[model samples]
Target: MRAGPLCLLLAVMSMATGAHAEESSPLSLSAGPQIIDLQQRLKESEHQRDELSKQLQNADADRESAQLSRLRQENQRLKLQLKEAQATAPQRLLTDQQQWFVTGGGVAMVALLCGIFASGWRRQRRQWLN
Candidate 1:
């Protein structure tokens, strides 16, 4: 009768240990799908990040190009404005040749007037003396 009770106790202890082992270990059937899903999600997120980065770079390049174009246009406009101002401005002072011509003409006129007055004065003096 003691042997029979001991055998029953051993069986009960073995069943309990087996149940504990099963509870402690992970179930492969559920874990496999979960791991695959997590990996797919990670890949998708990385792809999206790469795409966004590329788009940002492209946008920056476009913005810089647009700014460059606008600056070029403004520079061209300024150049045109400068040209127009110069064209519409007044003439500068007389050139060397023109100044020399005016000086020579004035000197000639003064010399001619002096000669005429001197000749007339000499004739009047001679007539008075006679």
Candidate 2:
């Protein structure tokens, strides 16, 4: 009879201690709030990262557009320069041809004048000797 009563008392004491330990532990109470807080922080950081990525993409597009415009302007300027050079090439050829014609005419005139002077001097010398 005393053994049976001691066994019953020990079972009740163990049950009481287990219940007290469960109540004292913080894991049962704070776990939900801490998990929720961490999830919210992660979402906020992801949103911030997306916003920064979008801004960087916009900046890159703007820079590329500016460079494209500059390149187009340079191409147009080069085309105009090429056209001007082509136009001057024909004019330069015409000028060279005119110079050659003028030089040839002057040379022919000088040769004719020299022939006339030589013939007149020979006739005068023959008449004087006779």
Candidate 3:
């Protein structure tokens, strides 16, 4: 019997507090002004971002144009240097030193072959005599 009365009392108290909360909630009057203020701030920030991006793009374009012209001038200079180098240099299959070395090698090979033939002839003659 005591538990039943205590539960009824708690229920009544909860209902009274709920009704009080509905009357005091802040969302009814303050939310509209706060939302408008936040929206205005967001718009201002977005406008600033757009303006900054446009300025950056213009600066980059100027820098790129200058760099492009410098690259072109460097390319032309290198081309002229290459043409001059090609025009002045001689094109040959072999240099003088390489030709001399090849000739010396051929002479040495011929001398070695002649020496072997002469030694073989001498040995054959001695064998026939014995």
Candidate 4:
């Protein structure tokens, strides 16, 4: 009868200890759907960050291209202004060699014209004058 009482007391103590152990057990924690939802939200946030980074990069490239175009236009306008300024300045017209060529061609043209007037077609006119 004493052995039976001792056995019953030991079994009750074991059951109480087991209940407390389960309450503090890490594996007994229950958040099955909550864990899956957290993971999915994290992935979506990462994808959004990646898309924002790409959009920022594209905007910077477009801004740089626009600035470069403006600089090119300004450079063209400056070149035109420089050309106009040069046109207003006094300038040496021609080199000595160019002047010689121009003068020589004019004399040649005059000689050719005189030769045409004094050629065989006008010999009779010269004889009649003589």
* Per-candidate alpha-carbon RMSD to the true structure: 19.9, 19.0, 7.0, 19.2
Kindly list the per-residue Cα lDDT of model 1 for residues 20-109, writing each as its tens digit: 998999667979999999999999999999999999999999999999999999999999999999999988688889999999999999
Candidate 2's C-alpha runs over 4 A off are 1-29, 91-130
C-alpha lDDT score of every prediction, in listed order: 0.93, 0.91, 0.94, 0.91
Model 1 clash pairs are none
lDDT of 3 by residue, 1-130 (tens): 5999999999999999999999997776768998999999999999999999999999999999999999999999999999999999988888999999999999999999999987875655345555
Task: Tell me which of candidates 2 and 4 scores higher on TM-score.
Answer: 2
Please give, for residues 15-113, the per-residue lDDT of candidate 4 as tens digits. 999999989977534687788899999999999999999999999999999999999999999999999999998896988899999999999999998
Error of 3 at 85 (Å): 0.8
Count of clashing pairs, candidate 1? 0
Off by over 4 Å in 4: 1-28, 90-130
* lDDT, candidate 4, at 29: 46
TM-score between candidate 3 and the true structure:
0.57
lDDT of 3 at 42: 100
Which residue runs of candidate 1 sit more than 4 Å off their true CA positions? 1-29, 86-130
Taking the tens digit of each residue's C-alpha lDDT, what string does model 2 give over 7-123? 999999999999999989776675899999999999999999999999999999999999999999999999999999988875554477899998999999999999999787565
TM-score of each: 0.40, 0.47, 0.57, 0.44
